[model samples]
Target: MPQARLLPAYLVQRYHGWKATTYQDNKSWYRRLAASGQHPRAMVISCCDSRVHVTSIFGADEGEFFIHRNVANLVPPYTPDGQTHGTSAAVEYAVTSLGVAHIVVLGHSNCGGVKGCLDMCSGEAPELLETSSFVGRWMDILRPGYERVKDVDAAFRARALEKQSVLVSIDNLMTFPFVAKAVEEESLTLHGLWTDVGEGGLEQFDPVRGEFLPV
Candidate 1:
């Protein structure tokens, strides 16, 4: 909870240079954002992978989308155990508090967590399931998914796992009472998307086709 005191002042210089062109034109926006409240259109749950950026891909400006990032964007079934999760809290607030109309789960190609779960590739068992180390447990949630495509060609298998992980996250996203209620009441729509990191291809979930289709 400490202030971002570690932020290098020089890094502000990078933004400073751009501020003249963009920051100057949007000075009112900065003022209003500071004074006004957040009114985002959607909530995006994405991976912690550095290569996969939600804001950049969607060209979302600050406050346009409420976002939550985790090692694999895993949404646990609503647990009343008093352990509040940032992702779950974001969903609760965005839906119940802010009334966002859509919730998007974004996953990408060549995810290390998916790969670990797909192949159970971790070297140590304790390390796999540890509270802080999530790949093992999160991967377990997708074990059925892994088995669902394990026998396919290696290239196809990888693609399937990455794609299936989005579905897994979507299903889990629904387990939260707020999310389910919102969806049931038609207040919110859920979307699962796969981004091909290499070429930035956008694929949307096609339930009828039982796969992702180019969009």
Candidate 2:
């Protein structure tokens, strides 16, 4: 639940006094619109990184991007074969119930989650990994991607890992029945995005071009 929207404003008024203007100015706006309901056009699956905010990065309004975040933003393959999947359920709601026409999988440069996985896969010194942590489980999703590019030149390893994960996520997402149906009907388009914070540039995934290019 959203504590910001639920807490009695006055209870924390002093602590949040700095944001008083935005809070008071938009006091009723959020409730009014949230009560009406959400009709976001796209659902974005992203990493829960402090620097990679879905709305700020995409310049989206309140409900423009139905965002679902996880440690590394991996999309597990759909299995009606009874596996519990929160991300899968969110995507189902977006595509089947809410009728979102697009879904974007966002990957970013120098992601710690991806780095952790790569380090683990390398059989590096024990000091390189911190297993038995939730972050370890989250990074495990990149195993397939890591295996795919393990033999690439050392110079391109970082870029390769990021790109590989984005492609893996796209492939896994398509395993969903609804996603397959949408693609068959051409009603939904799946996109992959890679963010470069240093240059502040966004790259779009292009399967045919086999590279991330300027959008």
Candidate 3:
């Protein structure tokens, strides 16, 4: 077996600091969580971008949210083909096991994954077109979203596509049988959101208006 390297000194120091402060202060809470297990009421599907802080945005405490992060915060159409599907697996667990009442697909401004998808679809990012590029293949899920905003003005295309990615994920979430059933029975609800990384602004998708409105 390959030996794993030790954590960096900086990370170890940070851990020690956290253990001495946060963990020590909330020792009983941590012990209760360990003994009981997580029972988050919501599942947040967010982008892998470090700037998009899911917990901080909602002011969530430990064991409050079941978060799944990926490129562009995508949820691909359900496919039960006996292949590995990490996002799908997370959704299944969140719905069937965790019984989360809400699933929020959170997209953000200046998202690199969305930008890459736009570039790739426009043929500008040729390297991502290669079969071996995992990101390219993953971003393929957003092709339908790209198609919707392909005619948008140059200045606003990226932002438009970013929101569309969240909508697409919400639509894709319904493709899962378990998710659909849960929603139909009124046990689960889905939401779409977009955040301005620079301005710290947030908007939510209103299904009735089919538009994103400030929140």
Ranking by lDDT: 3, 2, 1
Residue pairs with colliding backbones in model 2 are none
Model 3 clash pairs are none
Off by over 4 Å in 3: 1-3
> For this target, which candidate reaches the highest TM-score against the unseen true structure?
3
C-alpha lDDT values of all predictions: 0.81, 0.82, 0.97
Identify the candidate with maximal lDDT.
3
Tens digit per residue, CA lDDT, model 3, 120-195: 9999999999999999999999999999999999999999999999999999999999999999999999999999
- CA deviation > 4 Å runs, candidate 1: 1-12, 121-132
Candidate 2 TM-score, C-alpha based? 0.84
Q: Write the per-residue lDDT of candidate 1 for residues 1-215, one digit (tens) a residue.
A: 67557658888888888888888999899889889899898988888999998999988898899898886666666776787567678788899889999998888888887877765633434567666765676667776667678778876787788877788888888888888888899989999898989998999998888788888
TM-score of 3: 0.98
Per-residue CA lDDT of model 2 for 1-215, tens digit only, reads 45466557776876587457765778687787679899888999988878887798767767678899886778877767676778889999999999988999998888877877787788763444466566666667788999988999878887789877788889998999889899789999999998886778899988898888998
Residue-level lDDT for 102 in candidate 3: 99
